[model samples]
Target: MILVTGATGNIGRSLVGRLAGAGAEVRALTRSAGRATVPAGVGVVEGDLDDPGSLRPALTGVEAIFLLRTGDTDTSQILKTAAEAGIARVVTVSSLLAQTHPDSSVGRTLLRGEQVVRDSGLEWTILRPWEFFSNLLFWAPAIRSDGVVRAPRPGLPSPAIDPRDIASVAASALLEDGHGGKTYPLTGPATLTPQEKIAAISAALGRPLRFEEDPSLATEDPADDLAAAVSFPGVCAVASPGALSTVEDVTGVPATAFRQWAIEHADSFR
Candidate 1:
């Protein structure tokens, strides 16, 4: 059976669905099974990554795992438990910041998690995805209320990716062989700035939206350092290697574009 952690999350939700659709025996691990909505025939079990002991029930009979790292979890202990439970393979979702901004606290934490997964003695694949298109949902409220997106660095660009594509690749790595010890950096097909993204949303909604450069909107909280780093612009733009075709190469499907994602999710902004 394949175990999916953070099953209610963006990527995990899609991964579980994809696995189930492929007729794989899948189990979704969430902190609250009662609340999670997964596909039919997929098992739902309550487990917490922070408390590895709680994962016993979820890990039973599982052969492979899609592990999603949470803030400050005991990754080593978690992997040790999975290994002891007879899980032979693991696919982890990490961030591109671990490669581009290693000096930052968030990057360091992600890198440490990846290293632990690598040393866990299980066949492992690491996915380092760039900024997610879902991050634009942060502006949904503003757009719905005033048809305006107020943020900093309106012109800074990033080759942001779709969370579903990340899930697709993760599913392939989990169920398919020949992916062990591989680390894939995933990105969308285009690099778009905040202004361009707003334009796409505008077109999707068939309305006019404005982009305001408000530097004050940039977050200063240390707790949200990763969000601030990716949302504000300069940090990622300097390090992005441009758009990559890894998504298509791995899943045999082209990476999603920002405009297309906007059209699909336009209702959120409406």
Candidate 2:
């Protein structure tokens, strides 16, 4: 059995669906069993990753595990539990910043998690992805009301990836061989600035939306909680050169482009 944590989340939901469709005997961990939406033939177990004891039921009979970094949890305990459970393969969804900026607290936390996975003596694969294109949701309301997108870091270009792309890479690592001990940096085909994304949304929506760039919304600013989720100076993989190629190498396919993602999610602007 393959166990997935954060199964209700954006990437997790996509991954769980795909893995189930591919005929994998999958189990998912959820904070509330009532909230998980796993497909038929899959098992749903209730557990909080922060509490190692809660994970035992989900870990039972599971051959591999997909872990999300739950900050403040005892990672060493989690690894030990997985190892003891005889779960041989572990795939972790790590941040690009973990490798780009190892000194920051957030980066260090991810690095520490990776170490725990490595020390557990189990086969492991880590995926480090750039900014997510789904972040465009932050502009949904602004666009819906006035056809304007208020984007942060309007000048910084990012090869932001789609969450489904991340899921594809995850499923590849879990169901296939040749990925153990490897760290892949996943990203989209084209690099785009925030304004360019706004234009793409406008084109996709068949509307004349405008880009209202906001400079005060730096990821470092305290009021921007959303940016904080993806922020860490000098740590994100978007600035790295070889990230896009790495995704193709591991997945045996090219990652989706930002424009395709925007087109598929265009209804949000309506």
Candidate 3:
């Protein structure tokens, strides 16, 4: 049986569907059972990675796991429990910044979790995805109100990837063979600036959208600055282009372009 943590999340939900459709005996761990609506045959269990005892029952008869880096609790004990339960493999959704960045708290947390998983003696595949294309949803409210997209950073280009591609890679690594000990850096085909992303959204929505630059990060508002610090990892001046081949190589499919994702999700902006 395969286990998926954070089952209701963007990537985990899609991955659960994919694995269940492929006829795998899928088990999903969620804190609340009230909101988890998975397939009919898939198992839904209440478990938290922070609390390993809660996961012990769910880990029974499980062979593989999809781990989410919650950053709230240390995962070494949970991973050790999985190893003791005879779980063979683990596929973790980590961040690209986990490797190149040690300053950010999120990056450091993920790096520590990755270390735990690696040293747990389980066959592991780590996915270090760049900023997601779905992050454009942050502009939905502004677009719906005034057809404007605002960002605090200026002149930053990021190769944001679609979540579906990440799910695809996860599914492949989980069910198929020959994916152990690999860290894939997933990104989109094109590196687009914030202005370019706004343009893409404008074209997709059939409207003229204006880009608003907020360089100061709104120092007066602590909430706004904190949100910016967490979400804008790859949108700085010195950010580099992320690797794009890992998606195609692992899933045998191309990563969805930012424009394509924009077109598909354009209705959300309206």
Candidate 4:
């Protein structure tokens, strides 16, 4: 059986379904059983990653796990519990900022997660995905209320990826072999600026939308300026090209283009 933490979350929720669709016995871990609505046949159990002792029941008969950063608490004890519970593998969704902003608090948190999973002696795959296409949903309010999106660095281009693709890769790593000890930096097919993303959403919604450059929207942290997975270093790195990678190389499937993602999730903005 495979255990999925953060089962009610965006990626984890989808991952549970995908794994069940792939015929894996999936056990979803969440703090609230009533809130976790996974595919039929998935075992939804109440558990929190921060509370390592609560995971014993969830880890029973489980061989693999998909861990997510849930709290500010340390995850080493939970990983240790997984190892003791006979887990053989773990696939974690970390961040690209773990490399670009290693000194930052968020970056350190991701690094610690990788370290715990790696030291647990289980076969592990770490997915350090860049900013997700779903992040554009943050503008849904503005798009609905004003038909205008406000963001900082409108000219900045990001090789943002589709979360569905990220979930797919995680599913593959959990069920398949040979992904252990590998870190996949997942990104979209093209480098697009915020303006381009706005334009894609506009096309998907079949309406005109405007992009407003708002420097005040930038975070004071400087590193978290993008307000996504990117960092201050990423602010500069994404400005240039060649950072984009073929998602097929990692997941054996083509990356989802922003336009396609916009089309698929257009209703969210509506």
Candidate 5:
């Protein structure tokens, strides 16, 4: 059986469905089982990653795990518990920033989690994905209200990955062998500037949209902060040189393009 932490999140939600769709015994761990909605035939167990002791019930019968780092969670202890529970494999979702911008706060946190998993003695695969296309959802409100996206860097480009692609890679690593001890850096098929992304959304929504470069835009919301962080100029460049092939190489499917993702999720901007 495979246990998925952060089961309700963007990547974890897709990961659970992908595993179950493949006929794997899947269990989803959530802080509140009452609130989590998972695929049929999947088990839901209430647990808190922040408190490692709360994970025991969820860990029962789990042979492999998809570990997603949550805020300040004690990863070392979690891995210790998983090892003690006899879970033999772990697939973790980290960020490319851990490799590209190691000095950054987010990079440091993710690197620490990766180290813990490596030290756990379990068969492990780490996924370091670039900015998620879902981060564009941060502009939903502004787009809905005025069809305008205002951000600091309009020309900066990112090969922003789809979270589903990240989940697909994780599923392969968890369910297949030959992936242990490997770290995969993942990205979308093409790099796109904010203007280009807005154009894609506009075409998807069948309407025009605007991109405004506002250097003074303040990021108060966590979502906005994340979107802004990924827009940083050098973060994507460092990771994108050869990382774009990882999704296709690992999953036998090409990495998703931002325009396609934008089309699929156009309702959010509408």
Candidate 6:
């Protein structure tokens, strides 16, 4: 049996379905499975990462686990519980910032989680992915009301990846072989600026929209949350030489483009 934490989240939601569709015996571990909607023929277990004791029921009979990092997660304890439960493999969804800026606190937290997973004495695969394209959902209200997207960082093009691709790669690592001890950094096919993404949404919606950059809204506070998320300095994997694959090189599937993702999720903006 395979266990998945954060099963109700964006990537976990997709990962659960993908694993079930691939005919794997899957168990989804969520704190509130009463409200979670998982695929058929899959087991739903109520568990919380905050409480390691809650994970025992879900870890039982599970050979592999896919973990999603959360603010309240105790990485070492969680890995220890899984290892003691006889779970042999782990696939952790990490951040690109973990690699780009390993010295930052947020970076250190993520790096420490990766280190714990690697040292757990189990076969492990680390998936470091850039920001998720789904984060653009934050612009849904503005686009729906006035067909406009407001943001800062106009010149910084971010490689926003589809959450489904990350799940797909994770499934590959869990169900297939040779991915142990490997760390794959995933990204979207194209690096797009905020304005370019706005244009793509406009075209996908068959209407006109505009991007409004608000430099005044930009904060230089070192403790700012955005600074921890996407404020990495001197790191541009998209512009770097021989950038890593969109995760397709290893998963044998193409990464979804932002425009295509927009088209599929166009109704959200409406």
Best by the TM-score measure: 1
- Candidate 4's TM-score reads 0.90
| Colliding pairs, model 2 | 97-235, 101-235
The C-alpha RMSD of each candidate to the native structure, in angstroms, is: 2.5, 3.4, 2.9, 2.8, 3.4, 3.0
Q: 166-219, model 6: which lDDT tens digit per residue?
A: 999999999999999999988888777777888888988999999876657555
Range of the 10 consecutive residues with the lowest summed lDDT in candidate 3: 218-227
State the local distance difference test value for candidate 3: 0.82
TM-score of 5: 0.91
Q: Count the backbone clashes (under 3 Å) in each candidate.
A: 0, 2, 0, 0, 0, 0
* Per-residue lDDT over 1-270 for candidate 4, one digit per residue giving the tens place of the 0 to 100 score: 999988887788889989999999999998999977889899989987778999899999999999886666557888889999999999988878787677867778778878877888889888887877776777898899989876555556778888778888999999998899998888888888777888899999999999876677666555553343343222322333334564688667788888998998999999
**lDDT per residue as tens, model 5, 135-160:** 88888998999997776554456788
lDDT per model, in order? 0.88, 0.79, 0.82, 0.80, 0.84, 0.82
- Pairs in clash, predicted candidate 6: none
State candidate 1's TM-score: 0.94
| lDDT minimum window of 10 residues, candidate 4 | 231-240
Model 6, global lDDT: 0.82
TM-score of every candidate: 0.94, 0.89, 0.90, 0.90, 0.91, 0.92
Angstrom error at residue 208, model 5: 0.7
In candidate 1, what are the lDDT values of residues 40-85, reduced to their tens digit?
A: 8999999889999999889999999999988888999999999999
The list of candidate 4 runs beyond 4 A from truth reads: 103-105, 218-243
- Candidate 5 weakest lDDT stretch, 10 residues: 233-242
Model 1 lowest lDDT segment of ten: 230-239
CA RMSD (A), model 4 = 2.8
Per lDDT, the best of the predicted structures is: 1
Candidate 1 RMSD computed on C-alpha atoms after optimal superposition onto the true structure: 2.5
**lDDT of candidate 1?**
0.88
